[model samples]
Target chain A: MREAALSLFSRHGYAAVSMRQIAKEVGVQAGALYNYTPDKQTLLFELMRSHMDDLLSARAATGDSGQDAMARLEAFTRFHIHFHSQRPDEVFIAYMELRNLTPENFEVIEGLRRQYENGLEDILSAGQSDGVFAVSDTKIAAMAVIAMLTGVNTWFQEGGRLSLEEVEQIYWDMVRKSVAANP
Target chain B: MREAALSLFSRHGYAAVSMRQIAKEVGVQAGALYNYTPDKQTLLFELMRSHMDDLLSARAATGDSGQDAMARLEAFTRFHIHFHSQRPDEVFIAYMELRNLTPENFEVIEGLRRQYENGLEDILSAGQSDGVFAVSDTKIAAMAVIAMLTGVNTWFQEGGRLSLEEVEQIYWDMVRKSVAANP
Candidate 1:
């Protein structure tokens, strides 16, 4: 049901989607949605929060292991691209509908986002320190990587000419080269 | 008046903003706004279309001057970052409020966007032909660069730690390294 709401919210702007519309899509009474979320804002917030948490935890579970910084960065890039491809609607809603979040909810999601970004920044910093990666600015480089990966969700389609795995590999290659130590 | 409307649209969002509210922001009667835009959709379309046109023209007027593909790419990157920084409101509205555009207007803006993307793609193709770039996929690489450059609008502030020039330099360096033939 929340998934249905997410799709609707993503396709139609958050402000334009109503409780009744979500309920209709879910084949339930509008009041029933209140049992899950207090209001539209809460629903939107929970959806984004849960999506981001899943993203973070998924990466965490992958573990840094014995991989080098560049390898770890590549792993993260592939995971990000794959995860977003699998849940394009949710990812789109999380990014494009973020403005609709209330102040309290917005802060929660934004913090999660910052943590995720910090993960990449940490990798870039480590790589730079280890002389495995070279970048002009770790902060901007991290943001650039995140932005580039997120863009795949905007245009990627299932069963497209480039499979998800292929796209991931290509992006990882680009990212690795972008911050390569000797570059 | 359009500036006020653009601000509200960027902050509050397109669907959430109304003609009366825009008129109030401009200190004019709601009916007076009709003289400029027939409706909210038209207003949104015009704002985005004009901004994209200005961006394209700005790049075109920057002069070719026998600059190599890499040099042209750098100039384009710097111009993009600076332009987006100066008109953050329009950039925000152009991206986030795109859904509010009518189908006809949407296609117009989308075409312009494709043209801009293709412009970058063309540069990449030329660079590859000149043995200056080593991109595995020109289309995806173009998208990545555009996404990264446009993302500056999301986080850049006039008085931020990094000056516009510094930001451009870092990003340009990243892009060059990302696609350099010998990196």
Candidate 2:
């Protein structure tokens, strides 16, 4: 049901989709959806919150424990690109449906997003302290790096002119230099 | 009518907003709207295409004529941040409503966007040739820089913690170092 809702919400706006449509897409009664999510808002919030949770959990799993700041930053870049690329629908909803989220729900999702961004900022801060990265502001730098990396989803296709590995390499090189004290 | 439509389209996804709602928002009857635009899709396409045209024109006005590549790049970074920050709704629709454009409209808008991006790429390519930048792929670098800069609209508030000037300086610093042959 959540999968059906996600597809509908992403293709059609969340507000445009409803219980009946989602239920129809799921091949179930509209009442059955209430058994699962209770309401459309819940469904939207769950999808966004879960995406953030999954992102953080996955980041934890990809931890470069005891690594240098540079290495950890590279790990983050790779992990972010790979994770977001695989889940186009979730990524689309996560960004596009923010306005539709209730305030409390938006906070939860935003908090999780901040935590994820802070992970990268922490790396930048550590690198700055270690005199490896000459970032002016670690917070802003983290956001800049993130937006740059997440942009892969906009144009990346499986069999494009460049392979994912090639694209990754290109972005990684730019990411490394973007914050490097001496490239 | 375009303003009313743009606000509606950006707030509600283009697919969700109807011609009746737009006409009401513009203080006109539904039948009267056809005199201005043939249909909702045309309104969306015009809003999007005009945005691109305006962006390109603004960019041209901010062009770094007879300047070095580094300065030109800096001008672009600052100009892009300032221009996009002011038109939050248009920027939002420009990114979010692409999925709703007709295929032909999509291509026209996409082509205009490419032209805008190519402007930045041209700067990067020139910088590379001039030995000021070491960008491996100028195309990807332009996109990365753009995505990073445009992200300001996602979180920027009028009286936020950082002034626009300050934010511009921070991003410009990162952009310069990101592409610099030697940071």
Candidate 3:
């Protein structure tokens, strides 16, 4: 049911998609769908929450923070691109469906987002303290870097002019230079 | 009617907005709305096209291309942030509504988008040729830079931690360093 809702919500605006349609997609009775998620809003919130949780846990698992600042930054750059690219629908909903989430759900999602932002900010802060990254504001730099890396989804295709690895390397090069104190 | 449609479409998803609601917003009869746009799809297409035209004309007015590559790049970066920051609704719709456009409308919008991208790529290409920038792929770099700069809209709020001018300067500094040959 969650998958069905994510697919539908991503393709159609959340307002345009009916709960019945999600049930149809899932091949379940409409009443049965509520057993999983009480409502479409809950489903949307769960999808967004799960995406954030996955992102944070994936970052933690990388153990990149244990490395030097530059190494950690590279790990983050690559990891972000790799992670976001594989989940186009979830990424779209995560970004585009916030307005559809209820106010209370919105706050929870925003907190998760802030946690992710802080994770990246911490890396930038570490690098700044090391005198390797010369960003005037680490918070802004974290936002800028994540925006640049996540942008891979806006145009990237698997069999496009470049492979994912090539794309990753290109972005990392730009990101690495973008922050280095003396590139 | 067009203004009403833009506001409605930007607030609600395009698919979720109805001509009747737009008419109500404009305080006009539902039938009268058709005089402005034949249908919701056409309204959406026109809103998107007008946005592209406005962006192109605005950039042309800047005459950034006439400057040296580095100066042109700075001009582009600052202009993009300033322009996009001013039109949160348009920027949001332009990115979010592309999928909602008809196939033919999509083609026209894509062409215009490419033209805007090319304007930035030209600067990056000029910089590359001038040996001032070290970008392996100017096209990707152009996309990356534009994404990063336009992303200012995502988090930047007036009277926040930084003024718009400060934000522009910080982004410009990062952008300049990102592509500089010897940062």
Against the true structure, candidate 1 reaches a TM-score of 0.93
Report the lDDT tens digits of candidate 3 across residue range B92-162: 89998899989999999999999999999999999999999999899999999999998899899999989
- Across A32-146, the per-residue lDDT of candidate 2 in tens digits comes to 8888987899999999988999999999998677999999998999899999999999998999999999999999999999999999999999999999998888998899999
Going through the candidates in order, the fraction of native interface contacts each one reproduces equals: 0.68, 0.80, 0.75
Expressed as tens digits, the lDDT of each residue in B23-77 for candidate 2 is 9999999999999999888999999989999999999987587898999999999
Model 2 misplaced stretches (Cα beyond 4 Å):
none
Separate clash counts for every candidate: 0, 0, 0
lDDT of 1 by residue, A19-113 (tens): 99999999999999888888887788888989988999998999986788978898889888888888877876776777778788888998999
Evaluate model 3: give its lDDT. Answer: 0.91
- What are the runs in model 1 whose C-alpha is more than 4 Å off? none
Ranking by TM-score: 3, 2, 1
Look at candidate 3 and give me any clashing residue pairs.
none
Between prediction 1 and prediction 2, the one with superior DockQ is 2
TM-score of chain A of 2: 0.98
lDDT, each prediction: 0.84, 0.91, 0.91
lDDT of 1 by residue, B20-96 (tens): 99999999999999998888887888889889999889978988548899888887788778877889788777777
- Binned by DockQ into CAPRI classes (incorrect, acceptable, medium, high), candidate 3 is high
DockQ of 2: 0.83
